[model samples]
Target: MLLETGSVVAVEPDGLWVETIQRSTCGSCAAQKGCGQSLLAKLTGHTSYLWVSLAGRSADDYHIGDEIQLGVPEEVVANGSLFVYFLPLLTLLAATVAAHYGIGREGVTALAAIAGLLAGGALVRWRAYTTRHDSRLQPVLVDDRQVVQLVG
Candidate 1:
């Protein structure tokens, strides 16, 4: 499980809307100017928001501005990254190879690769929609009682 602490921005019936600030160690890094992470951090800004499931705890237990710990399964991130990235590349390669050898046309092969990439993207979108509500994919409250901070 990967854990992060975020401040509750809003309380929902079944979950909490948490806001986390993205911090980078760019100031301490030697390659601050050259690192891709540094560039991304600059471009993406510092704030991120996510919905965290309550994990059977009552919403009444939390209030706005309360800091809480949330966890996401490591395998979920790894598997999701693989499925999202590799599927399109594999499809594109397969289509390009088949078109190159079977049809023996350079123009047709390029078009086939483009078509395959689009098909793969469509599949990814469909799968994401289907699994949007899957519990295994959601971040869960790590501890119900361990409030990091409470604002009265």
Candidate 2:
């Protein structure tokens, strides 16, 4: 699980919006000394922030002025990333091979490539829908006590 520290930006009856601060990897990159990206990052500072609305969490215990943190499971992040990158590539390769065998014509190969791209995109979307439906409940909140402390 990944724990992030943030503060409540807005509170609804059951959910809250949190602004989480994140650190950049540019500072730690070996090319940072010479890279333009590194210079821009350094000038802008290494911190980044995002505000996300968290659903199904109890906002009663949290006041608007209170600080909060969140826990995101590793499995969720991994599965999402895998589908985003690997699934499309796999589908494209499969389609290309199938197309090559099904039609030897250049025009046919191009058609197949286009079809494959659409099919791969659709498959990824379907998978995402299936995942969300399979998980019946919304995300729950993590108390401050449950948060793990890490030393840099």
Candidate 3:
């Protein structure tokens, strides 16, 4: 499980809205001072916050200021990343290859690749919507009593 700590910002009947700061890992590297990512991080700052809904617990169970730990399975994260990234690339490649053999036009082949990428993105969106309510894919309240700070 990948755990993150957040404070309860709002209380709903079925869940709690928790807010957490978005952190970047660029600070940990020895060459961070010379890295583009480090410079971008410094320029953008870490003021952005993410609000997530945690199910399976009611507002009455936790106070507004209570700190809690949220978690999602490692496999779920990996699978989600793969689905988001590789699907479009695979479709683009397949479409380009098919267009190359069928139409034999470079411009048409590029258009086909774009269309395939859009289709793949739509498919991923549909899959995400259908599985949005799945317990395994959703972030759960792992430890409500632990008040430790989250690290990137």
Q: Count the backbone clashes (under 3 Å) in each candidate.
A: 0, 0, 0
| Regions of candidate 3 where Cα sits further than 4 Å from its true position | 22-58, 144-152
Weakest 10 consecutive residues, lDDT, candidate 2? 132-141
Stretches of candidate 2 off by over 4 Å are: 19-58, 63-67, 133-140, 145-152
Tens-digit per-residue lDDT, 42-128, candidate 3: 787733333455443445677887778788799999999999999988888999999999999999999999998998898899998
User: Which scores higher on TM-score, 1 or 3?
Assistant: 1
Best by TM-score: 1
Q: What is the lDDT of residue 3 in candidate 3?
A: 90
Alpha-carbon deviation at 30 in model 2, angstroms: 9.2
Quality of model 2 by C-alpha lDDT: 0.64
- TM-score of every candidate: 0.75, 0.59, 0.71
Estimate every model's Cα lDDT from 0 to 1: 0.83, 0.64, 0.74
What order do you get sorting by lDDT, best first?
1, 3, 2
Q: Quick one: best lDDT, which candidate? A: 1
Q: Which ten residues in a row have the lowest lDDT in candidate 1?
A: 143-152
- Report the lDDT of model 1 for residue 68: 85
Runs in model 1 deviating more than 4 A are: 20-48, 144-152
